[model samples]
Target: MSKLCLVTGANGHLGNTLVRALLAEGYRVRAGVRDTSDTEPFAGLDCQRVYVELLDEAALDRALDGVEVLFQVAAAFRHWSADPEADIITPNVQGTRLVLQAAARAGVERVVYVSSVAAVGHDGSALDETSWNEEVENPYYRSKILSERVAWEAAQALGLWMVSVLPSAMVGPNASRLTDTMGFLESIRQRQVPLAPDFHFNFVDVRDVAQGLIRAAQSGRAGQRYILANERSSSFADLLRAINAVSPGYRQPARAPRWLLMCVAWLQEAQAGLGGRPARLTRSQVRLFQGVRQEYDTGKARRELGFQPRPSDAVLREAFAYLWRRADQ
Candidate 1:
């Protein structure tokens, strides 16, 4: 009998791809999702489906029963929410704590926690697994930083064999819905973005991240963190050029001035506060990425896990092609 694995948030972009990856490796998979009704992502996939709410301890325990490995990939990934603490922080920090506790109770052998680059601090230099982001203005970033710490704490206290994988802006195929990264690309392709912001983003393929997670589960040292990101960061303009090369007729917007961008972001936030939809651009996002270089050192993953990531241009092109196909359909 193959080892049983349970993947939380199996309907998410990275989670679904990881489920497919695990299935391809011949492991028995149990996909934990919020709603079984939204089965489009799992269509035709041979796997057990279970409803998983991170905050629900009984549900998580039921899902983890007899599982050899647990992949805790669910998190409230929102930059702007009407209520940041309740909507973003509680679900992420408290939810992670509950899931790990339940996994401990269920006697799961190993766990792979999905963290983000947001947890890693950048100080205009290339960051590695050792760096930590102590201060962040964005609620999403704060949640990740705190949640990762909680995961580590749980692992130590419960003597659980757990490893954390930090991935950068994940881009590639197998996305059932438009993620923030994919949506950003679509906005560029449809010419919705009038001016490209002066920001740099570290891009990584979601498939590679999935592979990294598996590798971590197989050989990663317990309590260690692995960063799944490109060696160098790509500017917003670089992303635009990659999209233009793959899909023609979309002009690259010029870089917007920092002051002007901040002013626009402030106005958008004010509008969102006045019973409008969440702002597409927020001050926290602007402050987080404006003129900042998002670079990382992935040598640890390559050397330890034998992880290899695709080029940013290739990732972007494939992502745009996938988006184009989805739009046409």
Candidate 2:
């Protein structure tokens, strides 16, 4: 009999991709989702479905029963929220702790935690596994940082074997829905962005990141973090060029001054505070990425897990093409 694997948040973009990858590897998969009605992502995929409420200890314990590997891929992923502590922090930090504790009790052999580059610091230098983002004002980033810390603490106390995989700006095709990264590219393609901020971003294929997670489960050292990202970073202008190359006729937004962009973000936040729609651009986001390049070294994952990501341009082009096709449909 093959080893059983339980993937939380199997409905998410990365989670679904990881499910497919695990299935390809001939592992018995148990998909943990909040809403069983959201079944499109699992269509035609042979896997057991379980309701997973990370905050609920009983549900997690039931889901983790007989699972050899537990992939903790669920988290509150958002840049801005009305109540940060309630909406983001508690679920992530508390949920991670509960999940790990349940896994330990269920006798799960290994765990692969899905962390984000948001938890990793970028100080205009090439970041590696050792870099930590301690000065985070963004609620979502702080949640990830705290949650990963909690996961590590639980693993140490419970003597659970755990590895964390940090992925940067994931993009690719076959996403069940328009993810935030894909939505950003769609905004660019649809000319929804009137002005582009001077920011550099790292892109990685979602499939590659899924593969990296599987590799980490197979070969990564316990108590280690692996970065699943492109080695080089791409400027905002470079992203515009890639979008144009993939789909013509959409004009790129003019580069805006940092001060002007900051003011706009402030107004957007104010509007959101007034009980309006959530702000598309937040002051925290502007402060985080303005004129900053997000780059990382994947050598650790490469050397240890044999991880190799596709080129950023290729990933971007394919992502935009998928967006264009979705728009046309």
Candidate 3:
């Protein structure tokens, strides 16, 4: 019998790509999302649609029944929040616990929790699965770390087989028109980023991340972390040039000074606060740039999980193409 797999957050970028990967692998997939009516993402896919409220224990219990593999991919990721603890931290930390608990109670075989590289915390050098971003004081980053810690704890305590995959900023097919990356790309295409942050991080195709997520479940050691990150770390200038190189009608972005940029970030945060929305440049993002160059080492994943990531350039090119297409309509 085909294994019954439950993938939460199926409506999200990585989640949708992962659902497609699972379907391609011939697993029986149940795509879980917060909204059952928002079916556009999962449209025409061969999978069951299910609604799951992360905090609802009874709802989770009902969803995990007869599920062999659990893909606990749901998490809130806001760049900024007036109340990070209640708005962002609680949802992620509590969601992981509830999913793991429900899976264990349902007697699920194994769980593949989709995590972010934000949990790994970059330090401009090679990073393994053991790397945690404890130094960074950001709500989104904290949420990932705490959630993964909780996942492992519950997994060990409940005797439920669990594996975690930490993917770098995933950019691949079927990107939403309103994601942060897309926003950045649009700004680049429009020359809106007068000066980009000097921050650096790895990027992995959503499809590659999805594939690696499966590989983690198949071969990853329980209680260990696998990073599905890319080999290249591109800077903001590099990104602007690359996007300009691949697309037309894009001017080169000038590098704004650090002090000026910081002031702008402050204004952006204040504006967002007044509007009750997260700013693109949160205090966290600005602070991250002042530190050492951030990057990750995926050597462990390649050696152990047999994972192979594509060139970041190819991913960026595809991203530009996708955005360029979107700009027309």
Candidate 4:
């Protein structure tokens, strides 16, 4: 019998990549997704598709049965929810607990949890896997940090080997939807953001992130976390500049003071509240990004998993070309 692996959120960008990688590695894969109608990405590959609703304990428990390794990748990702505690936190925290318990009951050997850089809050220093971010006031960040903690605590109780992989802002082609980096680039293309945040962030190629996750499963220490980020720390303006170098015709957005941006965010959020949808701008973003500069050292991942993330310029160039081609089509 082949080694069995379960990858939740199999339809997502990273999940999709990991599924293919696992199949190539000769592991029998169980793809846990909400929809099976569109397996276009997995065409010609034979695998099992299981419907996974994160909040549904019975469904997740059944999905975990007979799996040797479980990759928990499904999480609620948003800055705001109609009810933050109920919608975001509850589902993520509860879902992780359920998966940890189910995996233990099913006698899974190891669980690899896909965490986010949001869980590691910003300090002015070089971030490593040990850095814990305290910006829990932001609902999305709070949910991720709390959910990771929930997974770790459950892993401790269940005596399961667990490794967490944290990915920075991701850049790649063929996005199924507008993710954070894509949305930011879209804003630049549309010239919607007349003012940009004068902050810096580390980014990684989605391909590298996917590869790192697999390496974590193979080589990461039990109960250890790895930052799957490259040395791509730069400001928003710099990122746009790189895109403009490839795409051209993009004017750099002016930098606005954090206070002024907060006021504008409040106004936009208020208008969005009246319109009964989440706002594009919010106060939480201000707390998270405004005037903040963060970078990470991936020495642990490099030494342990032989993780080698690519440079940002090459990744951003391919991303811009892909987006431009889509625009032309």
Candidate 5:
């Protein structure tokens, strides 16, 4: 009998892709979606739907029934809010706890937590499972750090079979046109964005992330964390040029002084805090430029789980192609 895999946040870009991948691999998929009626994206897919919230005990239990593996991909993903700490902190930490508990209660064989590289330390070093970004003075990063801590504690306490996969700057075509990465790419392609940072990030393909999650579910070592980074960390200039190569009108941003950007960030933060609206330059967004360069030691994943990520350029080209086609439609 094929194992039953429950994927939370099944309607999301990554979650939805994961479900499709799981189905392709012959696992029965149970998608935990908040709205059962919004099933158009999952239409004709070999998957069942579980209408539930992360904290809904009864509903969560119902979803966990007969679930041999669980993929915790759901999280409150937002940066600017009146109480960002509450909006991000509670759901991520509490929701993860509840999901793990539900999995343990249901005797699930394995659980894969799709964490972010935001949880890793940004000390200009090649980060891996052992490193973490606990010292960052930002809300979103703090929330991710706290969530990973929660996962670690739960793994130790329940003796649960779990592995954490931390992916950096997930870029792919499926992200909505409004997502941060997609928006950035779109603006760059349209010559609407400016002030590109002179920095780099470990960009991972969303398809690779989906693949890593599946590998984690099957062959991953329990209680371990894996950093899923592409072979090369692309510079902002390189990224701009890559997009420009495809989109004729794509333009690069003029570099701005770091201090000037800091002032703008402060003003944006103050305005949002007082007006209860989204901030232009959130603390997370600010630190993203100032934080340590994102590079990772994927040797562990290679030796253990046979993870071989493609080049960043290849993924970016594919994403650009997909976006180009979608925009034409």
Candidate 6:
């Protein structure tokens, strides 16, 4: 039988790219989405799509029926939820359990779990697969770490084959409704971005991430986690310069002291707690900005998976073009 792969979050940024790459690899596609009606991207392809919420067991079965590989990418992404732990725990942690259990029961050949680098711990030095990020101060990171553990546990208990791909701050252009990198770009464009953080981050194009998922499904060893990142690390300032290069009139942000920002973060968190409207700084947002100098080594993925990432400038050019066109509309 031909490989029938089910990609959850099929309409999402990376998920859409994964589906296309799977088709190119000659696998029959089954999109696991919240609504089958939204499969516009796959309209011309002879693919199966099922409306399935991650936590809905009945819906999961309908989506997973006869699937050989499962690509679990759907997860709650926002760091601050009105309910914090509750927002992340059930959908991300519990939903993953549901997918893995169903895959085990259905005898799926392998599962590729799409995890984020946010879940990976940042040691004081360069972090790799072996390093565990200890200071997971937010619900999103907490949920991802817990969810990854559930996946590994399920792999051991059910003898299921699984691999986790941790992608860094993704940089690419696509049809995703999610803000992701675009949110950062918009802040820079509108000159609303704060003074550059001291932190550094690796970025990969969505295409590279999609191809990495395909490679993981084919050649990845079970029960292993791989860090997928581009070689160069870009600071928030570098990102701004890239934007200014493309979008005329973009001004560099004034430098704000980190300690001052921390104070703003505290007040923002307090306001959110009081059911006030959104603020510029919050605990989650500040924690996000804390790791300005951290770097990641993608040597493992490059050596093992033959993963080669495009240059940061190329990624910036593509993202800027996409964003500009959209902003014009």
Candidate 4 on 1-329: residue-level lDDT in tens? 77899999887767877887788888899999888787765677678999888777788888988999888887777777667899888888888888888889889998899988888867656688888877778888888899999989999999999999998887775466656666766666667888878768776778788788888888889999998886547787777877787777877667789999899889878887788687777888887777777678789989998999888776666667667776786
Q: Give the top-scoring candidate (TM-score).
A: 1
Which parts of model 4 are misplaced by more than 4 Å?
A: none
**How many clashing pairs does model 6 include?**
5
Candidate 3 global lDDT: 0.81
List clashing residue pairs in candidate 4: 121-133
Q: For model 6, what is the error of residue 271's alpha carbon versus the real structure, in angstroms, after optimal superposition?
A: 4.5
Q: Which ten residues in a row have the lowest lDDT in candidate 5?
A: 173-182
Model 3, 37-68: lDDT tens per residue? 99788778999988888999988988888999
The residue-by-residue lDDT of candidate 6 on 130-150, one tens digit each, is 776654667777888888888
What is the lDDT for 263 in model 4? 97
lDDT of 2: 0.89
What's the true lDDT of residue 310 in model 2?
90
How do the residues 53-150 of candidate 1 rate in per-residue lDDT, one tens digit apiece?
A: 99988888889989999999988877887788999988999999999999899999999999998999666688999999986689999999999999
Candidate 2 off by > 4 Å: none
TM, every model: 0.98, 0.97, 0.95, 0.94, 0.93, 0.92
lDDT of 5: 0.79
Deviation from truth (RMSD, Å), model 3: 1.6
Among residues 3 or more apart in sequence or in different chains, the pairs in candidate 3 whose N, CA or C atoms overlap within 3 Å are none
Residue-wise lDDT of candidate 2 within 173-211, one digit each (tens)?
667777767778887887888987887889999999999
Residue 13, model 2: Cα distance from true site in angstroms = 0.8
Candidate 4 minimal-lDDT segment of 10 residues: 173-182
Supply candidate 1's per-residue lDDT for 133: 95
